[model samples]
Target: MTTPPDWSKEEKAVQAVQMAFDLSNDIQRAFRVSAALQDMSTSDMVRKVLQLPYQKNRARPRLTITLKDEDFELLAEKYGLDPLDRATIRHRVSEDLRAFAGNYLTES
Candidate 1:
């Protein structure tokens, strides 16, 4: 607004109306924000808005118990487990295989 008031009266009126509209929007936002703060502190709103990170629970180690065909079939019957041969087991449950070998293997 440092520029001279050289414009005609209509432009001045339009500028005043736009400033009024901006002020109204700011006032309305302030009221809504004030009401929310009255119900709960601003810190509470921030904490709720910014979610805390999720923490993972510690899980027990997995073990592989190889079952004989009949026993495996019995396990399959009892727990509804699909039969898995050693090679298939090695491929499917690769994570447990190393731990199982580590626990039972003789060092070469």
Candidate 2:
């Protein structure tokens, strides 16, 4: 990920900063739709939206996991995750895994 430019009072008030992003077409389309729906410039919308998780004091990191279909289904059911939604699956699994790790650490 690219580092965001500093937005300080001392910095010059530039109308916009151009940066190239290597995002998937689907993501680009989604951002465009969201910007249109909110009646805002795409750049402004993207900046505001991207700041949300940071504002919440949440860390955004990438993780990859491989599981058999049956295993995934079982975990999804146990965690009340929707199998059709990959985002929900990932969120549920991350939450459950973190909880498990915490419990294990405490018990140890």
Candidate 3:
């Protein structure tokens, strides 16, 4: 099978240690939504908000979000894509972020 054109292979490093916060639901949702609208992952968003140095030239430059089976089902239905096609679902989500940012700019 041919690799999808949108997918790129990258050399990955050992996983970095992750830090998670236990924010109130409202706060977490607000933070996550704000980042999504800006086409940033929460990690990058937090780094920017805290005035930390931006890490450049990442091995893989991509946004990530944890999704449950229900989310995949919902998003697949929303995008009219097959539920089993995770790669396509991911591409659709990235497209959605761009669309959200575009709409947000006109509204602002």
Candidate 4:
């Protein structure tokens, strides 16, 4: 098991800063695909590529993704929920993810 970076430590303080870089769409897709194949997050993959120490299990253990208004509308239609209800949509998405992981584990 790997340990997450300690923000309280001065040497690991830099890890507190969030950073982003512009990359080509193809590169982004490829990187995501590779990470998924290895069952790792893209952040962990980037850390691995840079030879930086990273934890497999993060302190927060939560997944996040940016979604647009259009995405919410689409998801609402797919799930037969009200588009304006963001909280319910979020809860439904979480439930779907949990169900997916359960199904995947049983199949494997």
Candidate 5:
């Protein structure tokens, strides 16, 4: 018997849209471990958790924040993130804000 061929990379990529979502720190860590084990992205895991349609496209807006070099370094240290990479810093801040929003909604 012959094994089927794997999907093309483009085919796989087009099956889902990439977007960001937040989990609690503990939950985020757990999902990170699970995603690593499965060799999947955390965004895909979040899609599973939210039961979003696999092929749907959602608008994702960008946010910009400006900070002094010293202030940026302080935030990086506080969040335990790398200060040199803007994308990583933004992603970390987005995750933290999402978690905060979730908590706020739950408590209100």
Candidate 6:
């Protein structure tokens, strides 16, 4: 059977760095892993070391919230729907709002 894409040495190095460890150790482990696993690129090797969810996963944009869990819960309860279920509903609402706003948002 044909093979899947392999991780490169550099990829491995990066992955090791991302792990919860010292920077020097991560770099060393990365090289060792790349050689042991026969990774194609350091990039790919890093992906393997980290056991990341996807091969081509790009960074997600982050949204920061200053609210504490208790405070957030109180706010969420006031709005309706348990905080636990808000994530899914919020995504749908966000998409709908974006589509409705569309070019009008940019024009103004």
* Model 4 clashing residue pairs (backbone): none
Please identify model 4 stretches exceeding 4 Å from their true place.
1-57, 106-108
Off by over 4 Å in 2: 1-17, 52-108
Output the better candidate (3/4) by lDDT.
Answer: 4
lDDT by residue (1-108, candidate 2, tens digit) is: 999876874365565456889999999999888865665556656777877322222133334578877877887787777666667787778887788869756553
Clashing pairs in 5: none
Estimate, for each residue in 35-88, the C-alpha lDDT of model 1 and write its tens digit. 354454433333345563322221333444666787656544544446654454
- RMSD (Å) of each candidate, 1 decimal: 27.5, 16.8, 8.9, 7.6, 13.5, 13.5
Name the top TM-score candidate. 4
* Candidate 4 residue-wise lDDT, 48-93, digit = tens: 8889997665555568899999999999998999999999999999
Would you give me the overall lDDT of model 4? 0.85
lDDT score at residue 16, model 4, on the 0-100 scale: 79
- Give the TM-scores of the predictions, in the order they appear: 0.18, 0.33, 0.43, 0.51, 0.35, 0.28
Model 3, CA-based lDDT: 0.77
Task: Write candidate 6's Cα lDDT for 32-91 as tens digits.
Answer: 676445624445455566785434433443333465667547756766657666675466
Predictions ranked by lDDT, top down?
4, 3, 5, 2, 6, 1
For model 6, where is the 10-residue window of minimal lDDT? 54-63
Model 3 agreement with the true structure over 41-68: per-residue lDDT tens digits: 6677788788986543344656568999
Tell me the lDDT of candidate 1.
0.51
Supply candidate 1's per-residue lDDT for 35.
36
lDDT value, residue 12 of candidate 1:
71
